[model samples]
Target: MKKHIFLFAIVCITQFIYSQNDNIPEKKTQKGFGKIDFLSIKMPETTIPNESNMGFTGIHYNLMMNDWSYAGLGIYGAVTGERGGFFTLGINAGIKKYFTNNFYLDTGFHFGGGGGKSAPDGGGAFILPHFNLGYNFKDLSINSGWSYVNFFDGGEIKGHQLNVGLEIPLDFSYADYDVAENDYSFDGLQKSNWNVNSKKSSLMLHLNNLEIKGDDTNKNVQNFGRATIRLAGFEIASYLSKNWFTFVKFDGAYDGIKAGYMDVFLGGGYHLPFNKNRTNILAKFGVGAGGGGGVDSQGGFLIYPDISIEQKIFDAFFISVNKGYVMSPNSHFYTSSYGLGLKYYVERNGIISDENSFSEGIFKGIEVITKQDLYFNAKRDGEPTEDMHQISVQINFDLNKNLYIAGQTSFANFGNAGAYAEGIVGLGMQTNPFINDKTSFFAQVLGGAAGGGDISTGEGFIVKPSAGFNYQLNNTLSLRTAAGYVKAKGGDLSSPFINLGIKYNLSFLKMN
Candidate 1:
């Protein structure tokens, strides 16, 4: 089945990419507002075996189209019912139907994979269909309505519930880099006229070594031993001021610990520059959630604080070293950690205004893709070989015209195994377009932490290698498909897989 899917994906990709006409239309891009929403849902007596009510917290970001339709990604995590580590990540799309005077109906659907804490989310495939009656005030809106949650691949968890949510709209601007460079006017500074003055953003990757605090004294720590554990993670930062910034960070265990351990933090930091603007001293504080790997994290809530020094190395790039402390305010998990990292400064594209955002520049492009994967004959602990399905979101940052860095997060959506997930980072390269400039070939290799779902990914380290073609649909959208092999480094899990995806391309221009 997996092999068939792979061949089918290859054929589809080839056909789509090579089918473009010689005279493709000139793409007219638009400016719009994106949105981020916070949501909550409660289920009654729906949990498997225990028949307990469950509570979930969700976050999602969407890009609004010219017609007000939107598509994006979302993640939901269980915050109650002893399901702290249970979470799902997936793609979403819907629209808002407006009525009279600030009132509207928001409807959408979420489909993804995830499960944890022995929940019967068989294969982790789930769907959520919902609708909300909302009222908008300026840039914010509040709503509540009915939602149906079901893990349909092979699970007994299903229920209907009331859902409440809040939405905040944000600035979004996009254009094809090549088109913008050739068509837009350039100012005295050699920057495009569509460029805006905004704060720079950053992406950083780190390797951390943590020493468990009071391993023998703390039961949670004792269960995992006093040995140091190594983690790999990434951080994203957006400046609020010259010296202040807000950041989101996520890390997963890959060495000296089980693979299922992971944490995410949201926090702020201050940076002080020195040494002729080449060095910076930073202090950061963060609080968020974590759990799994048999570590008690008190419902997955945690706090982390750290300090570091960053030294500029090249254009828009830096190197850093940091020391930090991690602790669960409500549990016995604590650690003192040190790590190294690589940082890249990203330009914010577009001019901000009251109603829209516009940014045009010749800059590095970024591609955001959502993919569905099928794995064949995948192995699991004490279970027979079975086919599996997964949903993943991948981000690619261009290094040049043909090379890029990629990061991805994946969750199992089917195959009789729930709570399965993977986080990966790697590098890729693409060939120039052929067949009337519509298609391109690409290849990449990724490795990272993967475990859970009873799959035999010993210690949670796995690697994937894939090759595919992308078919450009327009200036901002494309179709992608790939065939790959996934194998665990320390476990017996292995499989051949196929991926189908949709890609959105945009540029993050340098601050004007």
Candidate 2:
């Protein structure tokens, strides 16, 4: 695939850059979490429905316990021009045998799930057995291997890919490091850390789907919000303590009949830990407003219980998945939704710190971000893509170093097609991509109401989910580009967006 070639080229480019940094010392550590971004392609001679030329791009993270063992997880998006595309989230365990300081071989097995309309191969569920050799640079590496994929639909695919990515440091081999080598599993990192109270406070921002169940009010539901394909909103969770948490969740989905849907919840819950604290079960209940079909379709109450499983893949970074049934009994409403979220924990006892990263003082305090976007594929069926320009401002309320809530507002111009505007509030997480502290990785999903734009068909609510990196131009300003998906209510029109923006990080006062 063309994409794969582009990905391989990136590796060459990065290698060139890494070599120029020869003045820097070689970073050979025993234990660390390296966050790597990869792109690859597969060419299967035996053409299957969608296996001809497949290109995949995603972020991969590895928890290397030492030079000889590691665990890996990646969330990737794949596409085949002739066979559609899908989102694949996978995890693998492997061992590394270094023949020399810079050369090593790795072999592993991967298991994961795939879904979305793009995943035509029966949800794209599969397992992969693979092996490859890699050469490590000071902070970069290259690995190429062959992988055999076995799909649930009786489809088998054979392919090979090369991964070129930067490393994310998880250096527990430094000062005050107390974990015994025996304590850290050599089989690769555990799926999760499993300690609930170990960290006092936690913050999470996520994208979720609302699948309304029951056949009684299918039509009415359509009149209320998107019944299916709810590329909807986000939720912000503030885990106050190990067993207690609070939430601010927003939902903006389409109502088949009209531009409808807007809901916000403020609630809290209790958590219980089992399985030696490797997993947690939580119950959260919230009361919020679901106003859309005018002022009268407002003031709704929601009660839902979610039992979630949390596992640590590397350090404070973890993954959570849960299923919930929601109902506004008084409103005669019943719906069920499933969610997958990535969470980072900030402890209550002390400030979160990464000695391997840039000084914590480089980040923190009130921050503001502004961006301009050009949205494509904004029109409905049989129509050419539309170019819409939008500008927005966001105010980030700092709660701590690694976590915060971002509130944003935007104005969009669709030319004669119509105009649109929105106000968004959501949670966000930030981390440095390298030790320099000049480059940052930010991921967030924002939910808000979109009105006044392209109102000829009536105004609808909108939800946008995006991720991107930032390059600090200086201490106060940075440049960023983000990519996201935007879905609107009532109108089946949605588009993928690329945003270019600038940000200002200000330290108004000091924090102890």
Candidate 3:
């Protein structure tokens, strides 16, 4: 396994170096310009004994001048051991070039590999033949290709391999032969422009089949043979300038059980274009339906409506709010939920398209408090009481122009007076997942801490890692709900908590 991983790394680095050649347009060529590239490779799926998986890491450097390509020695290695004590080593060399803007070919021979003998015997040699197809617009480039590996004396390990990968150049530089003044700039402007033009579409098709078996009294059920089908979906949109443009999208899901259900959404919105680029507000509305029990059955219609607001603060974070309503009767048996959510985006995109923005700095306001309490008290030899209240607050930070981090803190004050504050804090990485719009998703993790009080004499911390899917509804209001496990430390009793809540976002206050 180690040997195989090492060889794979060498191939990856070689490819990266070849791809980074200076493919710039120029006028004169008294002295041809060259380019240097570095590549990294990752193994697909391979498991070793007592080890999670066997993989290799490689770094290759290549230089390209005119049509002649030269690559030096590459180094790679793999780690394989039982829990601990693992080692690896590898080496390789190769030469490659592009025949066209989209097609390239290469041939490489790799040797020298090693792995842990006690861990697992994973070693092999190979002669690799590679072919690649690539498309470049501005700064964005997409490449996919396959390679054939001929193993030298390895058991059942020589065959053609097919894999796909993507490359996102964090910084790009090009040489200009037309002018003798300076090389190209790495300001990321060209790369950003390329990203705007080379946008691809996403196609999504979902089919669900469900089975239920239980009595109406308990409502307890089991699921079986729930077939899920996902088809390709596509969309294409680009930025006009900074944060303003028009976009159209088509997304829907279908299920083939219990009268089935289907939903389709198609709508678009643009940035306000006035409050610098740090603040973006958008609205989307679409129509969808669900039905199954044959055509005679009454098919229900649904309205997909949402609004989103994003604001940046300081220079290292941001905050956003979303609210929306979904009216559907097929699934969840004629149920409707209105939701509001708040989030923070951190480590921004390093661009400040706007400076004098009103939504700058951190938006810190008096925390909003909402509570629901349940009490049970007894008067006798002993007194017992229990109550719970939910409290929530929204926080926003200005990470940069294109990035920000948002979060929500919610706690359940058990009202035991002595019971420690028990609640959950949700932290999410926010990004605009739509084209020319501010629609985004929050990848979050929830956790909390508890202290021993009069009610329960114990102390400990609680951590729950959870993931939630959120859609921005509109400005001022947002909807959010999440499910996560609850663990108690210092004590023995623990239970998971399912949380749901709505928030109202208020911003741009005058400071006294």
Candidate 4:
């Protein structure tokens, strides 16, 4: 059995590689550019216009790992309005080679298949290769490509695509290129890409209304009159160029008739200047993920594309009006935000480089966290379950500054009509429980397997969601309190839980 398994694993890996670049040449060429991150959008069926119903959209993060090689991670999807579901997303790994200046060849593969309607053979056995040829000029690129998805039952999806992409410059050095001959101005950058000589950081406070909308044609799923608030948000960002900037934002909003909610998002955009920098028109595009509006604590994937106009009235103060949509994938709807706000800028010769800010982040905000807790089950089979001590640990990953993704597992008393153990994954949102920056709050929505206990019904599934608060008393310790609900298969909603435990804020040692 071991021999058979090992052989099978080898075969699968071989197949995965072959599907990626079997026909591409292995020739070497001039190393062109350094590492960078880029986002690309593909127009499917570009070659054969008749197949336009299925389109492609994607965002990719890539880096130059070596002199001759490039590595990338891509999150993309396939769909068309009134047709295929947009949720058929794909995560891809790819490699590229820059044979010469601004020209490249690439190939990528996605093992997670199933793009559209069901077929006799599950797309699980499908692996695809998307190949492309592209040319780069400054921070932008255009490409032509083709992708082939092959399923085991002889079913396939093939498409030719045209794409436009933008690269986030990672290096600021002006001496890397032959500017005199290439006309690169500085390090292959166009004149517009140069950073402003008088550098400054700004804060934008915005309040907007969130109007939600979506429809499910398959089952007639409809939602309406659901409104959320942008209440207010602060964007802490810096200018990359006179025309471009990136922002990290924190916000507080009302979740459609609820108390309040929070979110964090990272975005970038351009400023169309007017009147010699006194007034500017702006546009921003980016993606975010957040949660924590209701009892479920479920997180939502967000796409924020907005436009605004800013007018400088005082030496350091400004005003603006913004409008945009907070597109959510899981919710299948968008929250439209439009309102007015104020902005203030502080000029500094250089960016902040103090260790104090980093320290404050540890005390006030953490990018990733691990939590452990002990709790009791409220009831089981319509009866209050007894001292049901449970141990659960969860890893929470921040999607944006305000939202996160959580994966967790719990061990419980399985013999008493409650499950023994379960593993779950969900979306969530959190706040800095700011009792002098010593506390925090969070919520999540999780669903996964719930079974294996002696008294559990064969093997059942469960949706376990929660909301919690944490207070820190020391560097290594904190106190936790949480309330959660577990709705098992067969309408079992009797297992609500409350827990208290000591939390350990894990940290790593960094070298100076």
Best-fitting candidate, scored by TM-score: 1
Task: Give lDDT tens digits, candidate 3, residues 1-512.
Answer: 99999999999987654543233122221212112122222222335333333233233323232353443222222212111111111223444556777455544444332222122222222344445555544454444456554323231224455433343322212212111122222222233321112211111111112232223432112121322311111222233444443332222112222111222233444545346556767565644332121111122334555565666664423354545544442332222222222222221112132332222212122112122222222011123433323333334322332233333322222332211223234345544436434244444554433322222312323455544433445533345555554444444324444444443333211101
* Range of the 10 consecutive residues with the lowest summed lDDT in candidate 2: 173-182
Quote model 4's TM-score.
Answer: 0.38
Report the C-alpha lDDT of model 4 over 402-491, residue by residue, as the tens digit: 576565544332223222344456788877448786778988897754332221212235677889887877654577778887665553
- Relative to the true structure, how large is the alpha-carbon lDDT of every model? 0.75, 0.52, 0.32, 0.47
lDDT of 4: 0.47
Note the residue pairs that clash in candidate 1: 123-417, 125-413, 350-359
Per-prediction tally of clashes: 3, 14, 42, 4
Best candidate (score: lDDT)? 1
lDDT of 2: 0.52
Model 3 accuracy (lDDT, Cα): 0.32
lDDT, candidate 1, 190-291, per-residue tens: 333343455567999888777788736797666877767777888999887778998988777777776677777778999898987689999999976666
Q: For residues 149-189, what per-residue lDDT tens digits would candidate 2 score against the true structure? A: 55453233334555543444444211111110112221111
